[model samples]
Target: MAFGSDRRDPYRAVRLKLFVIQVGALLAIWLVLLSIVYVLMSSELYRVLDSELRRSAIQVIQSYDHNHLSTQNANNQSDFGAAYSLWKITGAASSMSATYIDGTPFIDVRTVYHNALMHPSGYSTTLQINGQPYRIFDALVNLRHGTYLIQVDRSVGPTQVTLSSLISTLIIAGMAALILTLVGGLILTARSMKPLLASWRQQQQFIADASHELRTPFAIIRSNLDVLLHHPDHTIESEMTYLGNAYEEVERTSALLENLLTLARADSNEQILNLSPVSLGELARDVVESTRPLAEWQQKTITLNAPENHCMVIGDPARLRQLLLILIDNALRYSDAGACVAITISCDTTSCELRVQDNGAGIPQNLLPRIFDRFVRADPSRHRAEQGSGLGLAIAKWIIEAHKGQVFVQSKEGRGTTFTVIFPS
Candidate 1:
């Protein structure tokens, strides 16, 4: 079980922790609020009950005083819709106690009368008789005959029923809220981690690809040096070939390092481009002019087609020129000797489009989706003869996007390829 647990995805644990914290916090707050509400409600109910008991006791005393020793008349008086009992007490003994208006005995006569004599001033307490609860108020009264004790009580059954119902409602609502919060917290935690997981995977892939690309140049340089060292007694004339091979590898390594640096800066958001209005038509013409000699040497033709007027876009001129050169270079490298490479510039009301189309061996359909990913090459060759470090298109895409533009490609195997860059006008 421990071995299996160690192999589990760490992010799942992190997500669970986040979900639990959020749900637990919500439940804690709910419980605190419910406790406060219950305390306040119980206090209010008990306060109202105590006030009613005091009022009933006062009314009974007033009636006894007005009737002047007429016990029957005072007992016959209504208790104002409340349950109460009148008791005549002398010393520790009670006699002839009237029952409550509801015909229920408030308490055991002997026990309550004894307690009333002990506490003559007044007091209120709760009692249970015959499985029913009551709030009892006991007080001593001075009448013309002698001192007497009166007890006022109201059944607390109705109040207990209402409080029980309230408790049930709160419990149900709390349970429902807790369930919803748990579900919602889990969903939100998963959603929030999606982008972070994607970025982590992408970074891992980028590191792996970068390491693979660097190994080739290092291996070439090492092999050439080993060959030279094995024949140390030879003269410079004999060693020239091996030395030149080593020099070429070193240059390739340097170029690869520079490309990696560019990508690193771009990834860190430090590649700040100087923006200005650049004429797309003029830039395309200059690139064609510059590459004309190379095209001639390879027995290939280069052409430029543009609008008559200057088509302008906001961009960093140097970076945009680099972007154009990358596409053109790829085209020239892949095309046959007699093929043609075309640079076209067009503009509409909202955007300017620059396309570099080449009649070369186009990219395979499967490789088109990730063509701009660094260290990804269409050809699967490890040899440096025809393939590059595979960072040119990636850098080009980054530069174009930095200027708030987009790069798109349309290619077919064995037909040709066209790379289109669009900039908002």
Candidate 2:
């Protein structure tokens, strides 16, 4: 059951959710972007069409300077020479001249505009004649005697072709972006989760180690108690002392087991944090005070440089306090005699930061990155002897991460180490 439950699928429900989110977001953004491009490009296309219509209208009006309306009026009737739509308003009476050019023929219309009233300067519209489309440019050119309606029509083959090409390009680009986003998002999600998978495997190994470690202490305590039971008549003071020591060892082992269990729950993301606004300065002060005796016992000087005013941040106060204690306790354990351990709490509008600096026999440069990893101890033997199960910093890291915060360390081999905790405000 344990192994089966841990076997995660790549296409799990959570991954599906991520895929949907990424694809939907990308598609929506692309749609909006394409829509904007289409609108702007379409507007520009219409402007070019309108400009050509205006230029054509000016040329056509200039072509007919002489009074040949009557002569051209008779030519309007003939299938061999098709008619074009032209309007001439001589006072209130208007005359339409229909002329044909090549195979294209035009209809006579009184209105200067296509759909609405055509502007006096120029207007353009789509016209269909004999199952062929034409872009018509119309204008009301004012001459000395009367107003002449000039129209110049141009076929929109090139513009339509260009628009078609643009649409194809947009579709291809959108598809490529979507495919890249899906593939890249999946790869990134997998990479992000790799550390979590590694941590889980390490935790399984730690549990096995912890079980063995716990059994040895329990066996020793049990055997010592059994020996005391058999020698009822001989109540040696040394035996009583031995029993007391065994009980203490049993208590220590129990505490270690409890810490391990807590770590396990934290790793599984089962421990829900009771988050609230916490006074970072006050928390640091309390932790510093609590660890003062430990520091003094080790002949180390513990200094607290908490803010004068309360530095508030949103977090689980208890967990934050635990993190502070873990860092301080670690410094005290590893630091040289009479070394200075400084704790500072600072805050801004966006975040609050807690820095714990110690002039300890600092961590090695290479091991600095893995210091927060579970069961990774700087000095394994001393860590065990100091009752440090090498899980303190790891637990601290988990708790900080649960609060959407971070824990990072900077260390110089011989100089000192500084652990920084950042929490969003």
- Candidate with the greatest TM-score versus the true structure: 1
lDDT of each: 0.80, 0.71
Candidate 1 residue 76 C-alpha distance from true site, Å: 11
The candidate 1 region of ten consecutive residues with least summed lDDT is 1-10
- TM per candidate: 0.71, 0.53
Clash counts for all predictions:
0, 6
Poorly placed runs, candidate 2 (over 4 Å): 1-200, 226-230
Which pairs clash inside model 2?
Answer: 82-99, 82-100, 83-99, 83-100, 84-99, 113-118
lDDT of 2 by residue, 219-272 (tens): 878888888888888767758776886877778787677778888787577897
Global CA lDDT of candidate 2, please?
Answer: 0.71
Q: Which stretches of candidate 1 lie over 4 Å from their true place?
A: 1-13, 29-160, 381-383
Name the lDDT value of residue 365 in candidate 1. 91
